[model samples]
Target: MDWRSVDAALFDLDGVITPTAEVHLRAWAELFTAALPPDVAPWSDADYFAHVDGRQRSDGVRAVLASRGLTLPEGDPDDPPGARTVHGLGNRKNDAFLTVLHRDGIAGYPGSVRLLDWLAGRGIRVGLVSSSRNARAVLGAAGLADRFPVVVDGLVAAELELAGKPAPDTYRYAARLLGVPERRAVVVEDAVSGVAAGRAGGFALVVGVDRGVGEPALREAGADIVVTDLADLIPTA
Candidate 1:
């Protein structure tokens, strides 16, 4: 399929564009390990690719917890960032991520940059939709904040009461922000849930970046095209 056929490109920020995705996974693993038990299998990259990345913070926390045959109360969204509940734990993970981001700074996925530049240069509208509250800061730190003309992130999601991944709301919002019909926009994602959301949104294309999501798994998630990286989609010069 030709990526250029789409009128606009909607991307998930973490694994799809930013190297900070790994930092997020590492922080999540550390936080989950400390909160859970040593006997529990540590959260692996595969697990993160499947369950955590691209998901909303509370949803990710719930997914990882469920993997351990455990459940936590769905604390109010108003719960303080560190109030010792499920929301608190999610906030803790965010804090860890911020520490890593501040210390290490931000980095972009080269493949993603290649694709974004190609898309932008061709005059295709581009937008970023992420389930992360820190998406703006991450982009700013990475010097990619202005590359995307539209950003619909976690804070906006919360403000609009949009459901996270596996729900079409976030991607739909992005398409609207880009002033493109959903059928004319493509959703580029690296997580299973994100692909599901794109499919549910009826996007013209769902390009899955199999960064850690195994090839077969992404195809099964309804990705219209599955590649190891976004560089695969760049039009040849």
Candidate 2:
């Protein structure tokens, strides 16, 4: 990839920069397995990739529920964590995630941090575009909050009514915030939804980080280039 040609880079938060995707996966499994009726299949990683990963929390809850022929009220965002509504279940998952985060802090993948440093050295602006509402908290726990000047996270999306991943609004918003056009910015993501968003947004390049989703899947999702790690993009000194 020609790093010099891109004016900015947009990155996803969980699987792309940090391993918090594991934390999220565990939380979701616990929440859904406990809540779902025994007659329904238990939540699994496959379910997550298909219905939840890279989506907003409440949206994820709806998707997962719909997959299982279940439905819940679209409860208010302020609904308590244990409420039975969709927002409530999503909140419950958030609580579980926060407990894990506080118990065990997070760190960015070394390769991702290396790429961030390289981009900084090149004076290429970087923004975070994530469907996770806890994006700020995760970044703070990982000690990486200061690295990104623009964050188009779930909170921002909700406030602005911007569509989440699988839609291009958030990524386009991030690029605009960085004072760059979609065609001049690159997107780095680990989720198929995120890759699709980048492609839909018409980014100059969409680089997929294949943490577990597989390279072929990323390519099919519209990633221009797929790598196992962000360090693969670093230019040799």
Candidate 3:
């Protein structure tokens, strides 16, 4: 909770820094609802929170499939969308998300941007850690591509063989990139998995931005503090 003691801050991309979570939510709903058979229950927001939110694309697809007692081949990452495999389904979801992103564009949350500016003014280092492979593209669309010097995203996780959120590896990797120890850094997350990651990494502080995930859930997931907005953390000048 002591801001002065923190050397670096690691942030989650979609729900925390930007409102792309809604975009992701809609895309996932569309993909799964269309894929389900007539007798199968339609995909719902609860399903997204449980199986897809804050997870890698293919991993989310596999989890969702498992939930429905279905399984698919682990197709190549380069498999085209609609190829009828895990990777293909994930790719299809990505395509849908991209379509929405390109059509509607995106902007960083004002509170999040305010927090970034506050951290910058304090000379604190910043990094982005996200399970989304589209982190870069989303950041670019939101005009925040250059704000973070280090981004530990799904692409980098695959390259380094780091486990995704709830594992802490990506957050730890980002701290290392920022030349800070895990205990000297803070993590801002909006997802349960991400808060768990920060806790598992032994970071100095895990701040949860409760977008839709309840405050109690965030705390149970290991957040040291929970706020409705990052603006709450900014110091009065």
Candidate 4:
């Protein structure tokens, strides 16, 4: 990789920098397992990859329900959990995620930290762009909040009226906030939709981290390169 040409690195919070994606998967499974019709297949990881990963929370709930051919009202964001509406399910999943997160805590991948340190040594600015509203909490719990000077997450997206992943607005916003041009910014992500967003935004490079979401899917979505871990990108010398 041409390290000199890269001015900034934008990372996805869940699967890339931390393993909170697993916690999210567990939360999603719990929500769907209890909520889906008994005849519907039990919620699985594949459903997450296809419909939930890298999407806004409410949007994910809507998509998952649509996949089951079950439609629900677009409930208010403040609706109580399990209210038989889209936001309710979204809220429920968030609540479940928070329960596990606050109970057990979370941490960043060692390899990811290595890469972050490498970038710091090189003066390459770093930012975080995530679909999850919990990005701040996750990064804080993982003790990585100080690494990123710029963060663009679900809450920011809603406040600024920026589109979510599978769209590039959030990434673009981060790059802009980091004071870097897209052509000199690299995006690291684990989800197909995220890589697709990088591609759509015409960033310098879109890096795919194959953390359960397969390499082929990420490549198809336009990842310039794929790696199993961020440490693999560090200079061997």
User: Runs in model 4 with CA error above 4 Å?
Assistant: none
**Which candidate tops lDDT?**
2
TM-score of 4: 0.98
Worst 10 residues of 1 by lDDT: 76-85
Query: Taking the tens digit of each residue's C-alpha lDDT, what string does model 3 give over 68-162?
Result: 88888998999999899899999999999999999999999999999899989889999999999999999999999999999999999999999
lDDT of 1 by residue, 189-228 (tens): 8888889999999999998988776878888989989987
Clashes of each: 0, 0, 0, 0
TM-score of 1: 0.93
Give candidates' CA RMSD values in order: 1.8, 0.8, 1.0, 0.8
lDDT against the true structure, per candidate, is 0.86, 0.94, 0.93, 0.93
**lDDT of model 2 at residue 75?**
85
Estimate the lDDT of model 2: 0.94
**Preferred candidate (lDDT higher): 1 or 2:** 2
TM-score of candidate 3 relative to the true fold: 0.97
TM-score of each: 0.93, 0.98, 0.97, 0.98
Q: How many backbone clashes does candidate 4 have?
A: 0
RMSD of 1: 1.8
lDDT of 1: 0.86
